[model samples]
Target: MKALKPRRFGWWYVAEWRLRGMRSYRWTILLMTLGNPVLYLAAMGIGLGALVRVDVAGVSYLHFVAPALLVSTTVAEGFNEASWPVMSGFRWQKFYLGMSATPLAPVQLAMGESVAVSLRLWVQSFTFWLIGLAFGAFDGLVSILIVPIAVGAAMATHAVVMAYVATIDNDVVMTFMYRMIMMPMFLFAGTFYPLETMPVFLQWIGWISPMWHGSQLARVVAIGLPEPGWLIACHVGFLAVWTIGGLLWARRTFTKRVVV
Candidate 1:
């Protein structure tokens, strides 16, 4: 085989390798991409949604919740992708060390992992959007924008988590994050209802959560949920900051952990 030069296109090479590794669990991915929407839409959109007759956020419960679900699901997947896989790269599998032996830079490794995670998030978000459409949970064609919105949210969340995970040496922090941070953000970040419904003190959770930012954006596009222009700009800016800042942080941590 010809010797390859990975310096210029190292991130793409790393992304390709990560994608090929995903084949090992392709069935799991397929099941999740398909089954989650069916079950959630059936339960929430049909089961509980029917029970609550009043509209939520100016639309039927199904339409209101569908976008939130899409964003939340992708965000959760972002955590999953960033957590164990990142840890495995450093600790379990030590793949980062192996890759570092080659010409690939540490930053390239981070970018590649991020690219792979983003691609998966896009597919999952798009799948959920299609299923939401079938269930009549969307307003119109413009709702397709929710797909990218969800992906952006997921990437922001994933990048931040990956940055943190790169620094940890064990799973204890991961467990703490899931129980104390992730679960709270999921339940309280305006996923199933409006943030204002909660007490004022608790609303801060949604304000800082990527899920909430993404959900709000998704709702606006998916069902025409009324939001002020300034708030929308804030959401976009917040997620952008998290995504870019997190990627930079991950690059630093990956270099520190893998180059030693």
Candidate 2:
């Protein structure tokens, strides 16, 4: 018998359709992505940063918050793609069943949404970084190099959350996960202050949080500071593993779910 061929992950078509559908709302997306951060900067970076300026990690308040926001928002947006939008496809829109009727696989649909979500995260983070720069929070060119790293960290964050989202048979459990798990992570993951100042027990949260890992790496790159090479490697590598592994698991599960 001829050797069996390995199945390829067919997600590009899924990506194409998602992207095509997004065109009509592109302007709205652009405005929301770009404009909201302007308000964030105006409100927080200027408004809040003004109230506090002792330097948490040897950086200004605005600078300190920028990196935290980058990772938090990335994860937040990624989870959005994984949660509501994906739910809409399966329930309100019933798009998944329709696609399942065709050659398109469930994994492809999920993967495509994850990719699209990455794009959304990229848009949001980059806009935040650029706006942060205008407000003098970016620090320097070294900070700019971290953009792609931040994106990777964000994508990795999306991976685990999206994988979990795909495993759900309904939306209720995931909603609880967001509130009980994700929201807390966003708040304590070194967004407003350095992880050093937190209680020893609470620091564990930041240690495991993908956003914190990404935030640390981002500060190194964005602020021209030196970090332990091994620590940096470990953080980035762990995030990568989560991302790739998440993609595989999510695709497989989604494929199975679509057939059922």
Error of model 1, residue 19, in angstroms: 0.5
How many clashes (backbone N, Cα, C below 3 Å) per candidate? 0, 1
Model 2, range 84-201, lDDT digits (tens) per residue?
6666676678788888886666767777777666676677778877877887877776677656777787777777766676667677887797887788888888866788888998
TM-score per prediction, in order, is 0.97, 0.88
Cα deviation of 128, candidate 2, in Å: 2.1
* lDDT values, one for every candidate: 0.92, 0.74
What's the lDDT of the predicted structure labeled candidate 2? 0.74
**Candidates' RMSD to native:** 1.7, 3.3
lDDT of 1 by residue, 122-162 (tens): 89989998988898887688999999999999999999999
Task: Give the winner by lDDT.
Answer: 1
Q: Once all C-alphas are superposed, what RMSD does model 2 give against the true structure?
A: 3.3
What are the runs in model 1 whose C-alpha is more than 4 Å off? Answer: 1-5
Pairs that clash in candidate 2: 143-222
